[model samples]
Target: MKNLKLLKWILILAALGLFAILAARAYLAHRAAPLGPWHTHVPNELTAAELARSDWTGYLEVESAIFTELEMAVTRQLDPADRVPANRYFDGSPLYPGRFAQDWNRSFVLDPDGPPVGAVVLLHGLTDSPYSLRNIARRYREHGYVAVAIRLPGHGTVPGGLTVVDWEDWTAATQLAVREARRRAGPGTPLHLVGYSQGGALAMKYALDAIDDPDLPQAERIVLISPMIGITAFARFAGLLGLPAIFPAFANAAWIGVLPEFNPFKYNSFPVNAARQSSLLSRLLQRRLARAAQDGRLDALPPILTFQSIVDFTVSTRAIVDSLYARLPANGSELVLFDLNRSVKFGPLLHFGGDLDPARLLPAAPRAYRTTLVTNAEADRREVVARVIPAGETTERIDRLGLQYPSTVFSLSHVALPFPSNDPLYGLEPDEAEDFGIRLGALSLRGERGALIVGADMLIRMSSNPFFPYLLDRIEEGIDSSASGRSGIDRDRL
Candidate 1:
C-alpha cells in the first residue's frame, strides 16, 4: 500500500509538471504574438507611457471650448485658403490649403532611424478628429512603420451651428497629412494612405489629384474602412447635392436630420453645411467617374482597397458599388465587400442565429453565406455588390445622375464588421455596444491595394486584442499578389 501511494503521488507530480510547462509555453507564445483583437504582444523590449488612466476631467472644460470655437470657425469660414476666417463667411475659397503647417500637441510613435518599412497617413471621418485614430496609429507603430493620424477641421468640437465645410477643405487636410507623413518618412519610404468613411473618400480624391505631381511620393497602398463614398438617393434632393454649390446660403434641407441608425455614434443631428460639403464631394467624385467613363482615364486612378457593409444605413452601398467601385479601372482596383448579416458564426464555440441573440446578449451570428465579390466583366461596367435582406423588406433601387447605374446588389448590414466587444477586456461588465477601434487597427495593418472591405463588427473587436500576425499575413499576401501584377483579387479569402 505504501509503494502504491508513492507511485500515485509521483504520477500526480509529473502531470502537474507537464501542465506548468505547457502553460508557460502558451503564455510566452501569446506574448510573442502580434498585438491585435484576440491577443496583445506586450513588447517587453519597448517601453512607453502606459495609458491606464481614464480620467479626462482636467481638460473637459477646455476641450469643450476648443470644440465650440473650432466648429464656429468651420461654420463661419467660407474661404477655402483661410483657416478659421477672421470674419464670418460660409462661401469662401473654392480650394482650401492644408492645415498641417499649424502646430498642436498630439502623441506620435516613430522609428526614427529605420529605412521605414512604409508610411501610412490616416484621415478621420467628419465630425471626428485625428484622435479617433489613436489606437490605429499605435498598431502601425508595432509593425515598424511610421503612421500619422490627422485631425480634420470642423471635427472634435461642439456641433458648429452651421455646416458649411466644402470638399476642398477636407481634401486639403488629407493632402497636409500625407505630405507630413512623406516628409517624416524621408525619400525612399513608400507612402500608404488609410482612411475611415469620409476620410476614405478624401484619400481617393487625393490619390487622383496626385497623379500628375512630379514630386509626389510613390504610393504603396490605400485602405478604406466602412468608407462613406456614396449617399442615398434622398440625399441627392436634400442638402447633400441639391443646393450647396449653387447657393451657399440656401438652407432648406429637412433630410439632414439625424436618424436613429446614427445613435450608435451618439450623434443626434447632422450639420447642414456639412451635408452641403458632402454634396460637393459627391458631385466631384461623380464628375471624376464621368470623365473616366467618357475620356478613358479610369485606368489612371490609383490601386485601391475599400471595405463596405451592405447593411450600413449611413451611406448608400449602391452608390459605392455603382459609382465608385464599378468605375475603377478594370486593371488597377478591386473591391472587398462583406456580408454583414452573415458575419458572426461559431463565436467562441457558440453558434447563434438571427440578427440579435438574446442568450448571447450580442447580435446573432452572421448567417453562413458565401461572398459574391467579382470585378472583371466584358461589359463597359463592372460591379461587385452583395445584399442580405431579412424577410418583408423591399429592395431599394439606385439612381445615379437621373439615370440608373448597372450594379450587383445584395443584403448586409452597416455594423457587420467584427468590432471588439466594448467590454471584451472586462470580465463580465462589457459595454453594451462594441468598439471598432481594434478591428480598424487590424484592418489598417492588414490591408493592401486593390480594395479591402470588412463588416463593422470585425473592426471593433480588434482594437484591444491586437492580433498582429494574422493581419501581417493578409498584408503579405496582398503585397505578394500586387508584385506579381495580379488584377481582380479573388474574394474567397476576405
Candidate 2:
C-alpha cells in the first residue's frame, strides 16, 4: 500500500515538471516577434528525387521558377503595413538583391578566359546565397580553373524556403554542381570541392560518398571553411520545440527567429526546420566518417584543407579536431585554426573564459595532418604569426604573416573566413570602389543596448577576415600547383 502511494506521487511530480517546461516554451513563443510575409511563404523548390534526375540546366530552370513564385506570392503580395525598407521582401527596398549589378544569389558558372586547367565547385552555408563564396570562385577563375557556385534549394529566395528543405535536397544539388564543374573543365581536369559552414559538411559528405560510388566524380582536393562536423545538442531536438505549432494559436512556435530581413543576399530570419535539417546532416556525416574509418575506406578519401575559428559558437572546434581530422590519413590535408586574440590590452576586459588557452583546443604536436595556428606572436602585442606543426613532426615552424588583429575584435567568427578585409559587403574596411547598399562589417556602433533594431551580437561579430591575404595565398598554393598533385606541406585534413 505504501509503495503504491509513492508511485502515484512520482507520477504527479513528473506531470508538473512537464507542464512547467511546456508553459515556458509557449510563453517564449508568444512573445517572439511577429512573422513577415517572407517567413510565411514557402517556395516550391524541387525535391531530392526530382533533383537527382535533373542536370545543371534543369536545376536552373527549377530555380528560376521558384524565384518567380516568390515574386508573385511573397514580394508582390506583401501587405501595406509590411512594406519597410528593412524587410527584403519589400519590392522597393534598396537592399533588394536584384538591384545589384550582379545577383550573386543565383547559381553561376565562371569560366576562365582560356580552356580551364582544372575545376572547382563552391557551396555556401545554410540560409546563405552563393555570395558567401564569390571571392573564392573569382580567385579560382583567375587561376585558370572553372568555378561553379550553386544556390542550394530552399536558399537565396526567402527565409521560408528553409522551412521545407531537407538535407538530401542539398546533397542532390551538390551532385549537380559537381557534374557541371566536371563537364565544363572536361573529364581529365582535376576537381576540387570547397564549402563554407553547412557547405563544409556537404563537401566532406560528397568526398566520402565518392569513396564507395564508382560513377560519381572523385574530388582531388577538398577545402572547408568553418565546417559543421559537430554542433550543439539543441539541434538534435529542435523539431520537438516546434511541436506546439500544431495548434493554431501557437503557429509562430514553428520559427526560432523572425527578425527583419535586411541583408541583400542572406536571410536574417531563421526557422526551426532549418536547424533540424542541419542537425540531421551533421549526424549523418559523423556516422559516415566513423564507418569509413572502421572499414579502411578512409584511404580512398582525398586531401582536404579546413579553416576554422578555435572558439566558434556555431560549431564544435573540438569536433573538427576529433571527429574529422582525427580520422584523416597522412594525406596532404591541413587545418588552419584561427585562435582568439590574446592581446594583453584586451585580457582584463575580455570574458573568453578558458578559450584563451589555445593549447587545450588542439592536441600535442606531431599530428597526422598539418596543424597551423594563426595567433598573436606574443600575448602582449597585436602582431600575428603562423605556428605550423607538420604531420608526424614535433618541432614548430613559425612564419611572420605581417598581420595584426584589430584591438576591438576578440576572435574570428564562423562567417568571417571566406571574405577579405576590403570586401564591399562584409569587410571591416569596406572598399571605396564598391558598396552593397551597406558595409555591415565596417560598422562600429556604440550606444546603450536594445536601442537598435538588430541585436548587439549581429553588429559586433567580425564579418570579414583581416588575414584574408594569408588565406588567399594558402589557397593559391594549391591552385598554382599541378592540378593532379597535392601540396608539399601535406597534413591531410577536412
Candidate 3:
C-alpha cells in the first residue's frame, strides 16, 4: 500500500509538471503577434512518390504552380500592417525577391562553355534557398562541371509551407535534382554531391541509398558544409511544443521564432515543424550510417570532403567528428576544420568551450580520414596556417596560408563556410556589382539593448568567412581530381 501511494504521487507530480509547461507555452503563444497568411497558408506540394516519378521539367512546373498559389493566397492578401518596407512577402517591398533582375531564390542550372567534364548537384540548408550555394555553383560551371542547384520544397516559397513538409519530401526532391544532373552531364561521368547544413544530411542519406539501390547514381565524391548530423534536445521534442497549435486559439505555437521577413532569399521566421523535420532527418541518417558501418557497406562509401567551423550555434560540431567522420573507411575522406582565432588580440574576451581544442574535437592521429586545422600559427599573432594530418599518419604537415583572422571576427559560423568574402549579400565587404536590397553581412548596428529587432547574439555572429579563397581552391582541386577519375584527396598535398 505504501509503494502504491508513492507511485500515485510520482504520477501526479509528472502530470502537474507537464501541465505547467503547456500553460507556459500557451501564454507565450498568446503574447506573440498575430500570425500572417504567410504563417498559415499551405501550398499543394507534390508527394514523395509523385516527386520520384516526376522529371526535372515536371518538378519545376509543380514548383511554379506552388509559387503561383503563394502569390495568390499570401502576397495578394497581406494586411496593411504587413505591407511594411522590410517585408519580403510584400510584393511592392524592396526586399521582395521578385524585384531582382534574376532571383537566385529559385532553382538554377549553370552550364559550361561546351560539353561539361562532370556534374555537381548542390543542396542548400533548411529555410535557405538556392542563393546560398549560387557562388559555388558558378565556380563548378567554370570548372567545366554542370551545376544543378535545386530549391528544396517547403523552401524558396514561404515559411508556412515548412509547417507541413516532411524530410522525405526533401529527399525526393534531391532525387529529382540528381536525375537532372545525370541527364545533363551524361552517364558514367564523375558525379559530385555538395550539401550545406540540413542539405548535408540529405546528401549523406542519398549517397547511402545509392549504395543499396542500384537505380540511384552513386556520387564520385561527397562534400558537406557545416553539416547537421546532430541536433539539440529542443529540436528532439519540437513537435510536442506544437501540440497547442491544434487549437485555433493558440496558432502561434507552431512557430518558435517569428521575425520580420527582410532577407530576400532566406526566411527570417522559423517554424517548430522545420526543426522537427531536421531532427527526424538527422536521426534517420545516423541510423543508416551506423547500419552501413556494421554491414561493411562503408567500404563502398565514396570519399567525403567536409568544411566545418570550430564554433557553430546551429549544428553539432562533435557529431560531425564522431558520428559521421569516425565511422568512415580508409577511403581517403578529408575534414577541413576552421579553428577558433586563438590570436591574443581578443585577450580574455573570447569565451568559447574548452573542447574546441583539436585534441578534444577530433580523434587521435592516424585517423581513417585526413584532418586539417586552420588556426593561428602563434598564440599571440593573427597569422594563420594549415596544420594537415594525413590519413593513417601521426605527423602533421604545416603549410603557411598567408591568411589572418579579421580583427572583427573571432571564429567562423555555421552559415559562413560555403560563402566567400566577396559574396554580394553575405560578404563582410560585399562587392558593389550586385544589390540584394540589404547587406546583411556588413550590417554593424550599435545601440541600446533591446533596441534592435533581432537578438544581440545574431548581430555579433560572423556572417562571411575571410578564409573563403582557400576553401574554393580546395574545392577546385577536388573537381580537378574527380575529372581525372582520381576519387580521393592527394595525401601528399596540403
Candidate 4:
C-alpha cells in the first residue's frame, strides 16, 4: 500500500512539473516582440542538389536575390525608429560612406601577382561575414598564395537566413569552397584550410571527409583559430526554446537574441535555429572524429596548427585538448594557447584555482604533439614569453618575446584570435585612417546598466588580438616549411 502511494505521487508531480514548464514557455512567448520584416523574409533552405548545380557565380546570384528581397522588405515594413540612424535600411541614407557596402558581404577571391605556389581557403565563424578573414586573406595573398574567403550561406545578410538554414547547408558550402581552392591551385600545389570558430569545425570535418573520400582534395595543412570542437550541451535543446514559434502568435520565440544591428560585418541578433544548427554540426564533427580515431583513419590527417585562448566563453578549450589533440598520431600538430594576463592588478580579487593551469590538461611526458603557451613571464610584470614543450619531451624551453600583454586586457577571448591589435573596429588602438561609422573596441562606455542598446558584457569582451604579430610569424613559418618540403617545425628557428 505504501509503495503504491509513493508511485502515484511521483507520477502526479511529474505531470504537474511538465504542465508548469509549458505554461511558462507560452507566457514568455506571448511577451516576445512581434515578427518584423527580417523574420518574414527567411530564405529558402539550400538543398544539396541546388548547391551541386551551382558554381560560385550561381551561388552569388541566389545570395543576391535573397539580399534584394530582404532590402525590399526592410524598406516596406520597418519603421525608421526600428533601425539605427543613417543605416542602409533608412530611406535616403548614403551607403558605403566609409566602410564596406552590404554587397561586400559576399564571397571574395584574392589572387597573387604571379602564378600561385599554394592556395588557402579561409572560412569565417557563424554570424560573421567573409570580411572577418579579410586581413588574413590579404596576408596570404601577399605571400604568393591564392586566398579565397567564402561567405557561408545564411550569413553576411539579415539574421533571418540563419533561422531556416540547416547544418548540412553549411557543410555543402564548405565543400564548394574547397573545390574552388583545389581548382585554382591545380594539382601538386599545397592547399591549406584555415577556419575560425564555427568554420573551424567545418575545416576539421572537410579534412576528415577528404581522408575517407579519394575524390576530395586533401589539405596539406589545417589552421584553426578558436575552433569550435565542442559547445554547450544546452545547444542540443535550443529548439525547445523556440517551441512557442509553432504558434503564429509567438513568432518572436524563434529568436534567442534580438538587438539593434549596428555592426555591418556581423549579425547582432541570433536565432534559436542558429544555436541548434551549430550544436548539431559540432556533435556530428565529434562523432566523425571519434570514428576516424577508432578506425585509425585519422593518422592520414595532415599537420594541424591551432591557436586558442585558455579562457574562451563560447567553445570548450578543454575539449580541444582531450577530444581532438589527444587522439592525434605523432604528426606535426601544434597547439598554441594564449594564457591569461597575470600582470593585472586584480590578483587579490581574482580566483587562482588549479583549473587556470594549462599543464594539467596536457599529458605528462613524451607527448605526441608540440604545445606552446604564451603567457606573462611573472605575475607582477607585463612582459610575456613563449614557453614551449616539444613533442616527445618533458623539458620546457622559454623564449623571451618583444611583445607584452596589454595593461587593460586580463585575457584573450575566442573572437580576438584572428583580428589584429590595430583593427579599426575591434582593436585596442584603433586605426584612425579608416572608420566603420563607429569604433566598437575603442569605446569606453560608462553609464547606468541597460542604458545602452547592447549589454556591457558584449562591449567589455576583448575583440582584437594583441599578439597577432606572433600569429602571423607562425603562419609564415608554416608557409616556409611547406615551400622547403619539410613536414615539421624546425625547433632551432625558435
Q: State the lDDT of candidate 2 residue by residue for 1-494, as single tens digits.
A: 99999999999998898678667767887877667778878888889899889899998888889888888998889989878777777778877777778888999999999999999999999989999898899999999999999999989999888988999999999999998898898866778899999999999999888777878888888889999999999899888777777775677878878777888889888788999999999999999999999998898777788999887888888889889999889987899999888899877765664544557767777788999999999989999999999999999999999999997888889889899999888998889786567778988898897888889888788899998889889988878764546543222221
Q: Which candidate number maximizes lDDT?
A: 3
| Local accuracy of candidate 3 as per-residue lDDT tens digits, 1-494 | 99999999999999899788888888899888998888888888888889989999998888889888888998999999899878888998988887899888788899999998889999999999999998789889998899999999889888998999989999999999999999998876888999999999999999999888878888888989999998787899898888888888888998989888888888889999999999999999999999999998888778899999988889998999889999999897999999988888775877765557778788889899999999999999899999999999999999999998988788899998877887888898999899888888888877888887778786667878899889888888889888667644321210
Ranking according to lDDT, highest score first: 3, 2, 4, 1
Task: Find the candidate with the highest TM-score and give its number.
Answer: 3
Q: Give per-model CA RMSD.
A: 26.0, 3.1, 3.1, 3.8
Rank list by TM-score: 3, 2, 4, 1
**Positional deviation of residue 344's Cα in model 3 after best superposition, in angstroms:** 1.0
lDDT of 3 at 50: 92
lDDT of 1: 0.44
Candidate 4, residue 231: how far the Cα is off, in Å: 0.4
Name the regions of candidate 4 deviating beyond 4 angstroms: 1-19, 86-88, 91-104, 486-494
- Stretches off by above 4 angstroms in model 2 are 1-19, 351-356, 484-494
TM-score of each: 0.51, 0.94, 0.96, 0.92
Q: Give residue 373's error in model 1 in angstroms.
A: 5.7
**Alpha-carbon error at 491 in model 1, in Å?**
28
Collision pairs in model 3: none
Q: Which model, 1 or 3, shows the larger TM-score?
A: 3
